[model samples]
Target: LRSTTVRNLDGVFELMAQATKGTRDAAAEEGAHVLAEMSPKLGSAVERQIGRLEADVEHLLDEVFDAQIFEGVAALKSHDNYTFEHSVDVAFYGVMLGRKLALGNEYLKDLALGCLLHDIGKMYVDERVLNKPGKLTASEFRQVMRHTVLGFQLVRQMPINSPRPAHVALQHHEQQGGGGYPNHLTGTNLLARTPRERFDTSRMMLLSELTAVADVCSALSSDRPHRAALPATEVLTVLRQMAGGHLNRQAVEAFVSMVEVFPVGVHVRFNGGKYAGSYGVVVKCTPGAANRPVVRLLFDAQGAPVPEGVEIDLRKLPDDGELTAVPEEGVSVEEYAHRLAIARH
Candidate 1:
């Protein structure tokens, strides 16, 4: 079964490479394509877990890590299907956080698979409810919340080496406090909720905690049926607020450090008349100083094109000269190129 799955995936990768020929980073493009493919493959694997398909799942994870998945995550900015894209994004984030913690290759593979399938139960959900543009009623929301348990059931059937994936499906929604849904279990209670009775509860597995962080970040940063996507900065702020009590503090901190406050390619505005009416595009983010990224000024204070793009490293600026705000809507590369062309003419 493992060999057959690998052969199938190899063919998929070749097709993806050919399909994304025009992309600047073909490996990244292939990563996104692989993610998209996994969405359906996961559902199939869950249906036939006794077939020992976990090896194939791990193989895909290996490819994702090797492809430098962040580029694929960036490529997702143009994709419209939030459901499939969100799973891939969470997997990318989970793998990144796993690497940052220096987890072994085996653990990283499990983490990637766990994050990718965390929301797989949502496949059973009603598409109208999932895609509705209005608020969900209490009943509808309850139905939606069942995905955790449903996902757990599916993953539990798989003959995987680690039980962490199934645990993640069930407990990713469970919080540090007893406030989370389904079971509202916390501390010892949370650990006890695992499928197996004998697993250690000394500390929640970092995989489960990290999956929660990735899940929250991916969901909040995405456009939902009920609301527009929140800014990454705002989502991180929300995560910080949830840390310690609702989320694992160390996991949250690790996630923040991995993604930074202002990720690359986001559009931001300088506060206090520094770039008053203008906007800047984040080009690079410093590891420790997330807020102080390197940006290319796209317009002047009066909203005219800068003609010559002016790049700034916020870390080099005085404390008082740092950017104050990032608008809810970010500018895209195409939009920036269009503006730059107008400025040039």
Candidate 2:
């Protein structure tokens, strides 16, 4: 990541804050509106809005070296709707990874736009099936799967200069091998599903591959109608397991590097009683050392607040003695303080 990219990402956070004006509902409703306008024709107003979003994302990529901006966006992930928040999250993650991959500004813009609208076709999906809390019947599942094709059709009508958004909408769900759905396109077969002018038979385009990674990440980190959100560590582990067979390995790796396994600000406890049952907040994540981060120790083994917190860099530990394990859901500040006060007596 470059310094300029980091600066741009900082700007993106400010832009996103301004876009929503401090309301998650407003942000979600704005995204919902965009998805609603996708039918029949894309219209000039929608196209311009998409363009503005693209430009904002491009600014985010212009300074990709900063982790603070990524952490800032991560802090805002507690949104209400899976539909709207998922789109914005995917766009943010996609652009972050794209910048890490050193993609040009124009390509980043297109990738961000594609990710933001990848699920626009889901607007046509049956609400009952989309919002169902239980396992879907086979027929219901099929209706859900149709969103990809529907999304492709809707995005194709947009006046955007590139066809990448439509292509991504069609191919994001397709796996690396011949196993994925709707079209089940594998290898050369996948090429036929996207526009021939923008894609080649030699390989899957990076835009689709990047968007797929972002889609999976955002969905896994979100609370869906069917399941609770998975932790970031678990999500990355699942993505790594799918690499080479179901996902693009390079894209997955880039995502892992950009977001890290632990991510900053998540509360965690050392495994095996390494810190005497103390809980800590992750302050910085070292790339490649996914499990080890610089943590600010806040609670002691006796369940007492540390008062002046201690910062520990887990990466410095010897390989044999490296800290292990993070709680599925990390300790909350309030929970920690309350528990500590009770134990002190």
Candidate 3:
């Protein structure tokens, strides 16, 4: 039934899919109402269960991150403009990334909040500007920056219990460079006083970073108000090159692993596996290798995408052909792990 609820709610996502320059506010308000209705029906136990599941998800990521040291990116399949839809996706992704970073409880809570309200600023932007088909003029862009201020003002007005997200609402666009608007503040200057140890920002900033990564990755990887998403591998490459100076290195690394560049539930084109090794998600296995790495023989392992089906575990070299040793040169193990998690989701 809970799964049914999620499915039904996901169905509602289509209603707001055509959203553009004029329907943002209505979409936000409708989304708010929809969430209000769904939260209660989900029940306290389900809520707690979801919460614990989130924790477990975080735990798994923490171990993965500790072992490899990376931030974690999201692998969203949709890109509708509904604020609630995008916000929830970002929050889920943020929490997942927070777990990977081994963030503390309070910070994790803030990260969750940050993920929720990181886009509160969008509420203030005109529907036209928010959904413009093309680039905006300098002045129009400046008006967009006002969303952060407007978001902070709106949150201050509300008697909402949480302030952590409100802060993210205010600082989400404040870039690493002092060039960011509102207060020409640079680097940490644009950040908020968070539950962080050093560069803390209610933990949301980090999630905001994750959100930003996911938001852009999803946008660039999917159809948007102005254009269609780009190639998945191209998206990864761009992020890789933009690391350090423009984006966070740790965050980028996690994101690459998160998407499981070697996507799950789908067959992979290995570097060199028998029949070139076309395999599906190994739901029963861990990150290393799918317990029964399903395969649907079609393509060779030369990085070429081919139509493959779910079949047998190719990891166990065939009895007919004696194998020398386990093959190496293919998909990254980290990608395999993240894909497994995504498949289970």
Candidate 4:
């Protein structure tokens, strides 16, 4: 409920994590009950839960786009909670991206609501296929893809007046050049435009385009049963690669500008340089230079933990590639918490 900008983001992140967990739990319960009873009267609970978190979402926007915090927060997800957690994260990312695109307050409200329930229809999917840890067969993938239409149908049944949220659920998966599913809807073409022009003209992409970018970013950056989360740097690269083809280019471009690639509290390793093989945690991100953060080295080249980490400003370094995201195996939520405790003490 705190709206102040936080200097120590760890505590703020913990609060936001609790909010997302609560929202996720409530949505999951409501979605399941609605699915089983078939009377479809649980929309109010989902809406109420999301409404309560609007302040928290605004707080999240004030802080860093810490992918590591989300990685740790989303670790709270079990197989059953995946969709709910994903929905909240998408809402967070979507609203953040929407603000970057200058989509005013009214549009942002709709975007947040749309992103929150964008995957509600997944409650109707087969649990086995939804949580399958292995590659899905073509037919299984097809079944999984039906969540879009199913989600649209489910959202339309809700009491909301605007159809924008329902359309978001339906068209989030749709791609440019007409290659997407459920409906082969083609989005606005930004390929011929400049970044400024794209930004000026991006509102036509609307709620669905914003949600699509957010959805892809959250899915790729978070752990899946099939694979571990990609590194933030790699996620940035993937977002760029998918921009014009699978996602809204204007949204993706705006997202890349705002995302914290080496977010605070993330474990990192020196890819090369004098500190090669040394491990560290990102302690700060210089605004507008997310890829270059201030690091506090926590482990030596021999993998021994340092009692007191030495801080290094990445921007002060001569080379940009001196530091890189640590491999997924190298990061531990405990280690991150421990480092924060040390800093706080």
Candidate 5:
């Protein structure tokens, strides 16, 4: 199975090299194509194939500078495309956060490449273990964890211009204070000759730390083999809880401040108040206040269409008025029609 998977991936890589054009979306799409072809395989074939993406990856970064982080949560839950889509989401998040931190252009490009291919090593793990519907046994879990080292080794062998990007694949799983996998690296460990230096954030490479933040956000917002995607609000709460211990405190805070927890395009329902039972789609979001956005009311409290849409700015609503995410199952046919009505607006 592994050999077959590797052979298929090699063919896919050759196709990607031929199909990838200079456009950023093309590069991104071709890269995703390669990712979708991955399975439990490892070796020079994987390494060489990844090298084929270098030009496209660099070209993709140039285009990413003006791109917004797309909110494609509904699209991402499709079981077959989850891995590829998740990688794209991570790249979007990492590059944007890199911009937020004022990283130089070169650094941003490296961050983008690293985040996009960070999980390539997962291709080396068996599909059974990777997609098991229940909790992994200890041995299966260890196989999953080994992807970090496998990814690091695979990336190191590639012809990528910079070595720093490889480290993002290697260390994004490492924690701040202590307990993490593969290597128990800390944020400030190298400079911690004295105890005081341990508290500083400079020891770990900034790109790695930033990618970690992006990686976590993307993972929480995505569906996995074992679980459904968490609502964006719950994802934010989990991110906050992990800060300072499991994640870099400063990076987490910066990410949270910039990302819209309740991003546009999601259908939401009023949790309580006069508007309770009303349905709407988020139309706009403010950076600093992610939980609240401008919603376009589509359905009334009685579950009937509003006829003519009405806009409400959630930030201006009373404290008791709250918007809750509507599950995929909760979207009605009428709501879907309204959602389609303004999709391009």
Candidate 6:
């Protein structure tokens, strides 16, 4: 007989808080059951592959290589599953960039190890706090942000030598604007440098940037705490825009190249044309015409389509007609899913 007035995210929190203790317990239990009930077999093969890399490389293997990581990332269609897998991927990539930036061998391993467990801090955080759909309240955000220092402190308890991992954990959120928390010192504070300069990015900066890119890319490219997966091309667009005085430009470029902006079998919209999967191994990636790289559009996620497969070899076209555009509309993995369902029928 009563209508509830709901306004901001607070209402949701209030509702959650008001939930009967048993009710909340049951829900959490069920959530855990569902998570356990579902076999994470989809990512099993990918995880196995990563595990096969050198012991030190188990973390950085995918981060350094975009294609392999995305392949694993794309396997996750839900936020929970994606977050579980993507963090590892980001850590791996961060270590890769740290190594490329010529961080010493010890730092390289420590950085890799640090990244491997940077978000391990989150384990101390509540899932509800971590996965809140809307913006977090200041207190809640502080609670969440505390994971950085908390993670560092926690890892230190594990008897790890070489403090780089804990520092990486601590600095991952420390930004260039000197705006990051848990130690908000700006210039000369935690790799703070001129915004957007490639060289401006220090070793920790590179690790953080690489981690951020990998984190967001994996987040957007797959799914997240609040939303479905974003298209890889659109994700890249967002990353480019996000680089405005925040992340390193050339570093991002290096990352894009590492990941093959247009991986094989990804449907893309070329300039003046329709949709098709990745044309071929990325031949070149320029800020201009980044999407359409003279791809040989394949029918499936694999090389070429079979049976009634259609492959458009853009290599045949002259330079003037080279592929040069990205998709205008938001491409949904859902649409692809629907198509697959139809094909199955």
Residue-by-residue lDDT tens digits, candidate 1, 178-266: 67766775544231245553454534556777888888887777777677777666777888998877887777777676565556876
Superposed on all Cα atoms, model 2 deviates from the true structure by an RMSD in Å of 9.6
Give me the displacement of residue 322 in model 2, in angstroms: 8.2
**Which prediction has more favorable TM-score, 3 or 6?**
6
Of 2 and 3, which scores higher on TM-score? 2
Off by more than 4 A, model 5? 1-52, 67-80, 188-203, 261-267, 272-283, 295-312, 316-322, 327-345
In candidate 3, where is summed lDDT lowest over 10 consecutive residues? 319-328
TM-score of 4: 0.62
Instruction: For model 1, give the 10-residue run with minimal summed lDDT.
Output: 27-36
Residue 126: error of model 4 in Å?
1.3
lDDT for 110 in candidate 4 is: 71
CA-lDDT, candidates in order: 0.63, 0.65, 0.48, 0.65, 0.66, 0.48
Global fold similarity of model 1 (TM-score)? 0.63
Query: Best-fitting candidate, measured by TM-score?
Result: 2
Q: Write the per-residue lDDT of candidate 5 for residues 1-345, one digit (tens) a residue.
A: 223323434453344333322322332323333333333244555456565455445555554554453222222221324556566667767877777777788888788778876786676567788889898999888777776765665565455678877778887888887677667777742211366553444455677778888888777766777787776667778888988887888887777776665667777889887788888888888766667789888777866666455788877875747678886567664665775566545
Kindly give the number of clashing pairs for every candidate: 0, 9, 12, 0, 0, 7
Q: Give the TM-score of candidate 5.
A: 0.65
Candidate 5 lDDT (Cα, whole model)? 0.66
After superposition of all CA atoms, the RMSD between model 3 and the true structure is 12.7
Query: Candidate 2, residues 72-91: lDDT per residue as tens digits?
Result: 33422332456565676677
Q: Could you tell me the TM-score of candidate 2?
A: 0.67
TM-score of each: 0.63, 0.67, 0.54, 0.62, 0.65, 0.56
The true-versus-predicted C-alpha distance at residue 229 of model 5, in Å, is: 2.6
